[model samples]
Target: MIADDLSSKIRGGELSPGVALPPQKELSARYGVTLATLRQALQQLEDDGLLSQQPGRGTFVAEPRAAYRLDSLRGFAEDLRAQGHLVTTQILGQTVAQPPAWAAAHFGDADPAVRLERLRLLAGHPAVHQVSWIHGLELAETDLSGVSLYAALAEHGIAVHRAGEALRPGVLDQASATLLRQPLGTPAFHSERVTYGLDDRVLVADRATILGSMMEIRTEREVSGLSMQWVQLG
Candidate 1:
């Protein structure tokens, strides 16, 4: 947990870039944990590519952030293909419950949440992890397992009006790395997007962190019709 907190602070920009953390001894004292525990935490962070240890230079944080252009919206699947990558999804599990706080907000304060976990693949390589939540009643009659999620909703008369998104860089722990098939030190993209129906009615929300190896995105200013860009993840 200490290691995770440290990673979060550094990733969240609380520690800032080029910031040098205290020596192991000082960190141990400050956190009130033993040297062994401190080292363990630090090791975990290093494994997640959040930090680099310098034999005589202590440890330095890593720097990596996706440069998103201001002009376009890239759908996850289409974006992967635009990059000449193939995107695939492995639906891991699904459950129904009250939507989590974040999902609740996106789904118009849904009383029931449909949670789905999927592993995203880019060109045959496991990339981002996807966790989608939808309003239960809205999707209750839908048969998932295949087909685009956005399409499924539309078929049910849910008109997708727009989507809202948030993004941040975060360290990859063992579990996340394992899921992405990368070493623990890899960087992951934490992202959240909420889709709204017509009249801005909440339809569904998806949250995920794409692995670095998967994609790149930028928006373009077009004078006329729609213009799109993407590179498939798998």
Candidate 2:
């Protein structure tokens, strides 16, 4: 009962994010419960991601985790921005060059491709590091700084019809850890995607590493319309 009540208050914004809760003793008295019972309720809230407990500092409401939609075709920054998240993109590098072996395999050719590297921050924190190889689109490094890559592609008359993606659990490497400001071996999600245009031609091959602690993958499904499939990889 106490957990439910506090959960409601937190969700309703009565307990705003970063706001500290009252002292445990005081809260116990107000709730007419023992300190042990009160702590249990607070533990429940913390487990539900509604609160955070610091060792030296008191408990505070936790900032919400970003929900990454697994079912969306939108670009990462674009999807989060639409949810009212403060997203910023830093172009690490952009160059017209021969595609890397892995990216070349997806494009099925050795044709020159534009390689764009980007680091995305959410609420001023590093969230995603991405590199993309484009086959048909010509883009300046500045073209993607303030807009979605998909939007830029659309402006060039390319529309994404569908994409095939694979995801696997990984730990951050030295370079990725430095970019994300996390220690080496920090948990992350690694994704590879090949997107096709409306004409059924491969347009872009992308690789992205996402911070596991800051983002949550979410999807909704009904009995008739499932959004997920599992593939057994050797």
Candidate 3:
């Protein structure tokens, strides 16, 4: 009950971000709870991402997480740039290969797809690790350094018309955690997408792992309720 009350206040904007909570003893007295119970309540909020506790320092409300918009065919780099952030891309690996199970499920016997792995940074901070499998083009002769897969495909006269995405909670492995600068088993967001080009041809099958602390899924629904847009924060 105490945790829920405090969480409601935080979400309702009564306790602004960066604002420190009351001292444990005082807070416990005000809430009519024991110190132990109050501490447990605060710990619950901390685990829920609403509070931050520092050693020797008091707890404070956490800042709002970044979000990503999914209403368009925008690339990871493009989305961050729109938020006035400097974006950089590092191509980890790129080659032609057989599609993985997830990719093959969408590509449907489209062997020899161009596979590319990338680590994208926002303002020098590691943000997302992504891998993509592109079909309907020969990317072996094309250069992808410093360019997004969407842009490279566009150069080959393939225009993305529509895309579908799925997102779920995940945990980072040792390899992914090292690249994203997070501890092993850290909470993460796992996203999969399939992009379509002209005539409904599949252009790209991609998967991405995003740092949960640095990103979230946002959706806006207009008052008229006719349209809704989904965005992700990185």
TM-score of each: 0.59, 0.82, 0.69
* Candidate 2: regions farther than 4 A off: 1-20, 28-48, 53-58
Rank by lDDT (best first): 2, 3, 1
Report the lDDT tens digits of candidate 2 across residue range 3-46: 88889898887988899998999989989999999999999899
Q: In model 3, what are the clashing residue pairs, if there are any?
A: 67-232, 67-233, 68-231, 68-232, 68-233, 69-231, 69-232, 70-230, 70-231
- Which candidate has the top score in lDDT? 2
Residue range 82-155, candidate 3, lDDT tens digits: 76557888888888888888898887775788888989876577889999998844787677767777787788
Please give the CA lDDT of all the candidate structures: 0.71, 0.88, 0.83
Q: Which residue ranges in model 1 land beyond 4 Å of their true spot?
A: 1-75, 82-84, 108-110, 141-143, 222-234
Q: Model 3, which residues run further than 4 Å from truth?
A: 1-65, 223-234
> On a 0 to 100 scale, what is the lDDT of residue 185 in model 2?
96
